[model samples]
Target chain A: MMNRDELRTALIEEITRVAPDLSADEITEEASLRDDYDLDSMDSFNLASAIHKRLGVNIPETDFARLQSLAQLMTYLEKHPA
Target chain B: MSDFLMPSLGADMDEAVLVEWQVKAGDAVHRGDVIAVVETAKGAIEVEVFEEGVVEELYVPVDTTVPVGSPIARLATQASVTPASHTPAEPEAAPNASVEADWQPEPSARPALEVSARTEKNDRISQTPTTPPERLKASPLARQRAARTGQSLADVTGSGPQGAILAGDLTSAAPQAPAAAEPKGKKSHAGFNPAEMRKAIAAAMARSKREIPHYYLATAVDMLTATHWLEAYNADQPPEKRLLMSALIFKAVAKVLRDFPEMNGYFQEGTYQPSPSVNLGIAINLRSAGLITPALMDADKLDLAQLMTNLQDLTRRARQGGLRSSEMTRGTITITALGERGVDSVYGVIYPPQVAILGFGKVSSRPWAIGDALAARPVMQATLAADHRVSDGHRGGLFLDRINQTLQDPEQLNQPAHQESES
Candidate 1:
């Protein structure tokens, strides 16, 4: 199980992997990376899949849109640790 | 000995810079092996060699710009006696009635002679070049497999011909085939410039509107039953294996397209030629920057799950690069879905040469008439922008209606589509 700090690092890495254009260090805690960077539904799905593969958390398709920011993702990951 | 020439990925491509070689001189290669990766305006396309042979010599080195039809490599095939066998007269491929019209010369496309002349003019572009140390010796499938997983290649041993790592070896690279195929080391290649992409899009779209006379049509499909079917179907499946509402829509479109052949083919050389099979192109937008449509081969033949998987793979590759030449060039027809983000419906511009473009808007629960009383049902807006040269409103109308009717009985589409889709 990853600690909160480890979770943050892992989450950012997965996000960066899904959208390789972005630098992992620049992903802010509260920024809605989804809206800010124009990551579409497909992008959201890829991000969710990446997180699932890397961290073992399967984000349901219905909840794909709601995953807006890195902070929100962290909270969800902490709540449902693999 | 035969020459492997650079294929024109699309109409806009006049020349491309050879990015890297997946093969080397004196190396043996099979037909369908990726010999090189060429950087076009469409991005890096892993060009496949179509004949089995030993690599005699690689003429164009990496980073050299070469015209279409220029021989990049010389292959001593089964017919060739020696590496010095006289160069055979370049064969002319007749536009086949069965497959692949995307790379074939359309009305505005240049003739073979001109392409050959251009190839000769660019001969000076190549400098003293050799296969780089960074080039991987693995098969195309194996390289793709390696890239997708971010699995380190340092430890994997090659066991195939010339010790090339095969796809089977990567299976032990566990938790493989993850849906996110956004490959590692993506930073090595320069990103597709948004400005250049916009310019390319502008050229294609402008040419489409100016050359082809287009007819537009729209209909609202009550996806109530389809949505329900998808929900119930996905409930039992794993997250990665689940199907989306778009999959149902795509299946419906591909299935329905078969019934209206004129609406599912290319309008090239002042004539409309219906494709023998359905290569349903999906217009995928890259951020807000630009668009690329990579087709799913035999879309109608794929069941719901298969269709969904293919779509996912196609979009992932489209957004991240690694789109093959055939995938980028061929589009017997295209479907653009803009509904998810915000739009109620999209009336897309017909991607040139291909006679039709289907658009779907967001499926929303709206009040609809069921015999007498109005009930809340999921309704999706569907629009068709088709070539006036090939199909009129009558056939186009019937096509959209068939999609509506097909979605009403999603179970029929779920069955294994063993029946051939008549183009």
Candidate 2:
């Protein structure tokens, strides 16, 4: 029942929660999480965990590459809404 | 009553400034309670008590720099036995942080990092001790700033908790001081001052090189089976549940240490004392501070999942400066993995008291042969730097071989480790 923008906002909030050192503005929609924000494996894991916990969507390891960027992740989430 | 001494964090650490007392008199402290926070060359570390008892007296006041093994506090225990017993208590099976989520910061739960800026205005600055070897309660950043500006930390009054000088305190203390115009040679990298940290590291490494007679060993571990097993295991799970290469490496190193006890303990005073449990010292580097080797208690016993969780928790806490005294001091053996950063191999200097250090390089695809057929396989070079006084190159080579053999069978690692009783 959540909109795309709402999901994105929720995702950013979760990222901010896990990594307080990062600001919302720095997390771009199109840019890769690793290249833009230096999101390491642990950071990415925490982000995926937040998304899964919030959206109730089980993002498998194989699909991690698809969720590299915020836009890509949003698209994936929208295609398979929880 | 047993005296809780200021533990020696490392060989280079001669003394540490007691930052704040987490426990006061009459407080019933558990075996693993963080009694106080002490500031060393590596930064502020939470000191944990080993005995279950009530705190009798805080012998050393806050902000006092005391020597190693010097009693900082006295604990009233049930029985006055094992006077020199600083060994950590047996850890709980699974460290369920959720069960104790709402636990207050009274040193009972895991000692977390004191990163939150305390705005409590210090009223006891007026009672600053006017001693000769003048010690100041200042943050590492503040100390670096003072050194750079050529201003002494003692002159600036602190606004932080218990009158500890924060970086913000320095700016307000002397805004237009003559020192700012002429900067000292103290270097800083990306807002992180590493000059003092670098010096500390140098001293530790120097002492390690001087005292410990080291023997080197390296082996190319074929991690193809392990890598494939991990991939298959991780493919079905979420990102959070996925196992890291280091986790497997840690398990392998720990499991192998059981057979080769000589390489898994403290070497001191012309004698080597082997520890009953394998508490692996994981060397973690901090941006603000230097290197710290905190233990992942009973590493040989933990499964891959538990090891992963513990590793994640330990690394996170260590970087945040939330390390317990037991974790900081009770390392049976040390492991340094630089594979993630693209390093092919690492020859680490052994953290003294500990006999061996295991280093793992990057896992890369290389031409591997099975009898006659050649195929590309993921290969990793694991190096072992051991104290020659306790172990020779033959034993060191065998230890590396055991690690390689253990890693070959990933299913063995994933299996529920048999419950081993601690001595």
Best by DockQ: 2
Counted clashes in each candidate structure:
1, 0
List, residue by residue over B1-423, the lDDT tens digit for candidate 1.
666667767545556677678789999987557777776555567786655678887877665777776667777777633322221211111122122222221223233332222232223222443242233344334444566676544346543433444333454443456323334343333234344456667877888888888889999998878888877786665567777777888888888887788987777667777876778889887653367788897898897888988888887777656777667666688899998777898998887778899999998989999999999988899999899899899989988888889889999888875653333
Would you list the C-alpha lDDT of every candidate in the order shown? 0.68, 0.69
Worst 10 residues of 1 chain B by lDDT: B85-94
Let me know the DockQ for model 1: 0.21
User: Which candidate tops lDDT?
Assistant: 2
lDDT of 2 by residue, B172-271 (tens): 5556643234332122111212344566567767767888998888999999999899889988887678888788889888888899989888766567
Model 1, which residues run further than 4 Å from truth?
A: A63-65, B77-190, B417-423
Model 2, runs deviating above 4 Å: A1-39, A65-80, B60-67, B83-195, B287-289, B419-423
Residue B85 of model 2, lDDT score:
52
Docking class of 1: incorrect
lDDT of 1 at B104: 23
Interface RMSD of each: 7.7, 8.1
